[model samples]
Target: MNRHRLRLVTFDAFGTLFRMREHPALTYQRIAQAHGLKVVSEPDRLKASFQDAYRKQGASNPVFGRLSQGSRPWWKSVVRNTLIGSGCPKADVDGALDPVFAELFDLYAQAAPYEVYPEVVPVLETLRTTVCEDKVPNGMGKGTKFWMGVVSNSDDRTEAILQSLGLAKYFDFVLTAYHFGSEKPGRGIFDEARLLARNCKAEECLHLGDDLERDYNGPKLIGWNSVLIRRNNDHPVPAGVATASSLKAAFADD
Candidate 1:
């Protein structure tokens, strides 16, 4: 890919730039234990229960319940349901859920629970400082006129998380589905990203993410360039899709 042609590069938040340091279920279990609520002994069971609750909550109250309810209440509901589904007594959960959810909320809002991928900083630096030889003649050799942003299907806490991880400085903007009213695998969020990048043309934008459908195919369907990062080799690369083992490899050509 020609770096000069791309004016904006957006990334997915979770599973791309950073990931949880440990399974969320472990964190939930730990918090529950602190609150004297004995959850299931097995972490996997709690994890499965959490996933189910999350999906159910999302379906009924999308965008972290931005419309019908608020994010805090929505999350509390998810936690409540997760704890109940994980076999915590409903009475015990009700008594401790507040503090438990509070701690979990604060834990996730900061960097304590997340680990930035090693290559993220270096790759972002390279992308941000890329110099276009062609632009030198136009008296623009100071740096490439490239912009970086994040477009994720998360709530507003994403910005705080990124800032706490020291990654917010690398981005010009961070657009979340909660605020933008659109999520990935849809054209709205990507278009909002383009608008945020000074209305850059679709073909002049690039996005990097982990999910094949949301990160790769979503952008491609709308004329934007995209690369799928498969850091773990978890899945097969589809025909004609740009694939990379990491962000470092994704832009190795650049």
Candidate 2:
């Protein structure tokens, strides 16, 4: 097993950092009822969809796969993907989705509708303060050179969402699926983020995320240290990699 001491810490956005719009399930339930779509009606089903929605978006965007993430607007891609995934016709997907997309926008008016995890704020506060107090490789002085960034499987809009919620300025840079033009599990997004973060050695940084494959294996393959934030489930720890029960635990060793 490789033991790593990190100088910078990057993150996987969406499930790993931001609060998911937990109400999406409820919103979808309403959509199903009004549209008579044979879609999920159960609470768990709706909750599941919130995550699934992004997966669908991540998988479908051609730009994301091309590694030009954050350069394009993912919201439009999202609307298109949502409609297609919902089984709407290609052309109708655009029209019928306008209002629904608007509803999501309304919900996500400023920052995403989902609340940041209880652990997130404190963890970020710690990182901010630590950067102010500690030294690391790369002349990273306490609070100044510690480059904090996010490699998200989301659109460029996510930056605005984070900024709206007061989390963006803390990030030196953010690379999303939109930025890379594809989502993770493919490594394209990760590579692009690393480039934006300046290709610091994998060991010099720790990546925190919620997924096993995308956030773990992808970066791990390239030598970056990984910390999986297991959410909504009890997962056996991965061999050679660390797991954080909460964001705070991730900073314990730091």
- Over 194-213, each residue of candidate 1 has an lDDT whose tens digit, in order, gives 88877877987899999999
Q: Scored by Cα lDDT, where does model 1 land?
A: 0.87
Candidate that scores best on TM-score: 1
lDDT of 2: 0.64
Cα RMSD (Å) between model 1 and the true structure? Answer: 2.3
lDDT of each: 0.87, 0.64
Query: What TM-score would each prediction reach against the true structure?
Result: 0.94, 0.71
TM-score attained by model 1: 0.94
